[model samples]
Target: MLPGTLRAALAALVPLVALAVVPPAAAAPAPEPVAPSAAPVAPAAPVTWTMQPSSAEGPDGRVSLRHVLDPGASVADHVTVANLGEAPATFLVHVGDGTVSPAGDFDVLPVDEGPRDGGAWVTLGDVEGAERLGPGSLRVSVPAASAVTVPLTIAVPADARPGDHPAGVVAELVDAGPSRVRFAARVGVRVHLRVAGEVTARLVADDVRARWQPSWNPFSPGTVRVTYALVNSGDVRLGARGTVSASGPFGAGATHRDADRREVLPGGSAQEVVDLPAWPLLRTGVRVHVAPTVVGEDAVDARLEATAVEVTAWTPPWSQLALLALVAALLVAVRALRRRAARRVQARIDAAVVAATTPPARPAPPASSPPAPRPSSPPAAPRPDVVPRVTEP
Candidate 1:
């Protein structure tokens, strides 16, 4: 029999030896799960606002402000500005001198610059916290999703020139926060104030020129580019439509192209260019015709005259001429060669005829023959009977 303590120790060693001999079954590592890529987030939408001509009551159905008043006359009008954003915004309301841009769009002077013409004659009504920026300029604040109606007055100067003094009332949105790059959005309505006076509708064409672009292919026609400036020297704003025509000398190969209609403010000029297909005539004549018409819905009572300008361009057919010259030179060379060949043939024929007609010298006799003595001229004649008797003897 074993002791109790020794038996218990043996039992513990047996379990430890079994555990060391055979460890727990090893587990295989699981694959790492892949996470999906995050989707791109869209940027927030920008805020927007609007402005238009209005009345004290509300926004009337007017697209722009138009008035025909005498010099020194004053007119009252209104403009409405609406804030469409969720937050309240401050706006700078000002009047600016209106002018037609080079792109033919109506534009106003910058807010920083002061207006001198019709814009200078305008004044804004007093509002709380309304700070005067300059002549005819003020700053006002509007509540979120609300509209502000502002009163304005246009008092034309006594010595203002007769004709159209174009201007506009602009509302520029103030930026909410400070930024490295500053940008302000602006909206406006045009103010067309025509001072009552003698109105003239005239358009002048200046610096008219034409250039010819020759084609590389000898058989195809070239293009003629015509350029000119259309000046509105009259008191009224005018639109014009013109035609560009090109023709060769003596009015041959005439081609006509129509120019698109364009509007020009008083004292403003627009540069126009047109291209037309033209034959490569030695000399080409280009004509530009500009006819003046009323701009927009204005009913002007004046004669709108048409202006025409003509210019000449040299469009030489260099490729065709070169090809023709090459052909001519080839023909000349062939003709020269033919003439030389004919001469050679003629020379050969002449030599053959001379050889055939020329008599050969008589060949020398093979043997020399003895010559008989010459008889006197008197003994030459003999009767027939005597000659026979002598022969018989």
Candidate 2:
């Protein structure tokens, strides 16, 4: 009660402690709610696709890629569509460049036939829906779990450039409703416009360094592997027979497998494979030789010169075996002949018993002992006479 100043200080401290204990519940600073912006959703990017066609048409399950178009075509063409997608997606292919006409975006434009050397357009349908596709072409659409191919045909302009023209074809892969896989195929189209006016025959050589299939050989019976290259120089396809000759101890022999016949397009190269019998030939150590025409009609008007090939022939392991067999057989025959001769001598000895056992014959002894028998009879008479004489004495 005496310390008034201490009471004032204590009162101030009491208020401070009360404030620390009870003041915290006052509207807990309006809890800041999380701003919805933390989980912002993103927009989806667009889906694009490309188409790759094959050299030929194929059935379902197989990807048909073949698509032909004119270089100067300006028509609206369609291509057979194939479904290679896992889900349903809308597909449209279109042609650009001069192939597109004034008819519309994917309209029909009258153009000349054949290629103009300058590349042209061939739309499947459109990205969404395109027009003015190339000639001899079409578009295709594949359904979810199904497939369909549509025809695509167009025309080429009469006045176009010459040589080769190139273009790019696109196949858009999409998921209409957003599905698992998105497949797109693209084709790189090349238009060869009759090579300007015309080009002469050309010659190309490949696999020039000749090599044997086995790379080695023996004269024994076996096959000689040979491979060569064939290039068509003329404007037309060339199908002719050519030969590769081998010279060895056997003889000079050659064979031609397939001669790029029937379909060797100009400026195209084909591989030639031949299987030659390693039997006896004109010489030993296979040598290189060529004979262009063996037998058959020349596919092209131009005559062909035989292409030479490097060859190798191995020694005949089989000949060695044959010689060895002959020697062994001769040895066995000689031994058998000697044994037979010895057997004959022994058999002759066994058959001749008389010559071995009989003593040598001698002349008769005559009557050397014949006289003894007569003397014995005289003794009886002599005895009688002797008895009479003893009585008288």
Candidate 3:
């Protein structure tokens, strides 16, 4: 099963819906319906309703209920219901307190739950009887193709809170089925009632925050996500409208994003998020605003209030830093290459300088062979030959 609030919101958007209230001077006797209710067990009869502001009370066919009254005051109005079926059909007329749904929609209290606040002050009666009827509810039966008008009286209590208090008066078809499961249709109109007083309107900003998403490319810009909450602290509801802005250093790259308008209930807040393109600067300024638009109140008399919040952020200059690092690395590499080349050139030059400046090494003298001992040997051979000759002589 859906939650109670969700169910009530869905009910408020039902197709069988209309709203209107008759002016004070328009009060008059509504025409007789001339209808009656049939047995409860009879076949389910198809029915439709046509509601309008009674001509005797005000204009013809006004579709919404609206009024502005001071405390301890009251007003008279009328709502007409038409039955299109061929048989008599019964309806239970009731009213409920109104509220703004989370989705920024108008809704009323559930049919099963009775009014607890200002809605309880309203009373109803049958036009023909001219007597106070049920508490937040009344029963009426209309014949086929005929209509009935019910008078509405809203009395403001002496202690009623000032501001807009929306309510609804509905005509619900009574289900008379045998099973526990019952189906019924209801048609109604919204009541825009304001308890007159000194009304104050205020909107506030809270928890303003921003997140940066850096782009992969160093030269390209990145994105900033700005988020904030708008609070309605006044006694009435309001619509929030404004913009979020982010700027880089020196305000060079600025981005403005429009906020989505949403209804905020009294004492309630709505969170808004916006994505903005931002530059790769070191510092950033982020601002969020809540500009209140008076809603469900008398705009002519009510004042519009606004609030804004600003925050400072630091964005890292990774791209620039990376570039500087690369340049430093290249300089280091070039210096190393130059030093290596200089060393090689210096080695070759040193060799050539020595060759041109220094003398060649001198060659050492060769060793002499032993002197010949031939003189003594030749002398002995000659003496032997000479000795032989002398002996013979």
Candidate 4:
């Protein structure tokens, strides 16, 4: 036998060890993540159980579990649990409200958190407490290789909101050893409950934002990361559909991407991110349209019941735009420089041409031309008269 101190220390480490192996959640976690596969069981554990929707032929062959009920309405259902181990085993049964993880995986309320939604509406014939399974959780024993059918009832309150309320009925295996480790291997089926009357399937896009990551090469394409929150403003669980479109001003270079499909619970919200390869145009108008879709059997009238919400975001490709502006400025500066240089060159050419085409100033005429032979003829006549007088003298 182990010493008292050793036993105490082992007991203290039990919960921590259990938590270390299990996936983390917002609340108290199970020893392992509940597997959704048909034969979900704890790894390396001897015990195995199968939980499936009730069936007339057998519980193993049912397709899915769902119910559409009016306010204050109640429905009877059965869940089949089987023990596939070699020896007899005891299992705990739990029913809890459902939620979706940030990673878009479906989950149930933690063991510490009681059900406030459809999980609270579930009642088991063998279980004492209806909500969170505690000390009052029902335990059932089955012989080796044997299966038992457990009957359960779900009631929708008169004031139950119309739409989808997801829940789960889990069959868990607990360790009863001295260490008291809280290891539970769970297997169960989903419960999709819809409270009838005016099921509003609507989603709203909120806080839509876009960020552009420009490529270093201004001529190449960049990335556009768009993010938005899908809020289930109506009273049902839904998946979002539609497209996110980005277009430059005046509808140039329009680009669009499809939104991924993810479940959102009624009154709950989820964030979606989409990355698109795009050319970095100067101004881009971003628009997101999310239409709500009702999944499961409750969606008979979904076509007419669904509604859509839209949001818009405008972003400027500053990096690419700045680069373009810089190029334009450089081009203008170069053009101005070329023009100035051409004007200087042309002025020099014009001066050279004029000098070559101009005539030199004529040599100045003799500053005073000799007085022309003023009276050559008159001198001759005078000479004739003067000669006659000299002869007479």
Which candidate achieves the best TM-score against the true structure? Answer: 1
In Å, residue 375's CA in model 1 sits off its true spot by 60
For candidate 2, write residues 97-116 as lDDT tens digits.
22321221111222223333
Top-lDDT candidate index: 1
Can you write out model 4's per-residue Cα lDDT over 184-277, one digit (the tens) per residue? 5687778888888775666778888888777777667777788888887777777877688887768777888988567888889898898766
Sort by lDDT, top down from the best: 1, 3, 4, 2
lDDT of 3: 0.77
TM-score for each predicted model, relative to the true structure: 0.73, 0.36, 0.59, 0.63
TM-score of 3: 0.59
Model 3, residue 45: displacement in angstroms?
Answer: 9.0
Per-candidate RMSD, Å: 18.4, 27.3, 26.5, 24.3
- Model 3 residue 143 CA deviation (Å) reads 5.4
| Model 1 bad stretches (over 4 Å) | 1-45, 328-393
Q: Least lDDT summed over 10 consecutive residues: which range in candidate 4?
A: 127-136
Model 1 reaches what TM-score against the true structure?
A: 0.73
* Alpha-carbon lDDT, every model: 0.87, 0.43, 0.77, 0.75
Residue 318 of model 2, lDDT score: 56
By lDDT, is 1 or 3 better?
1
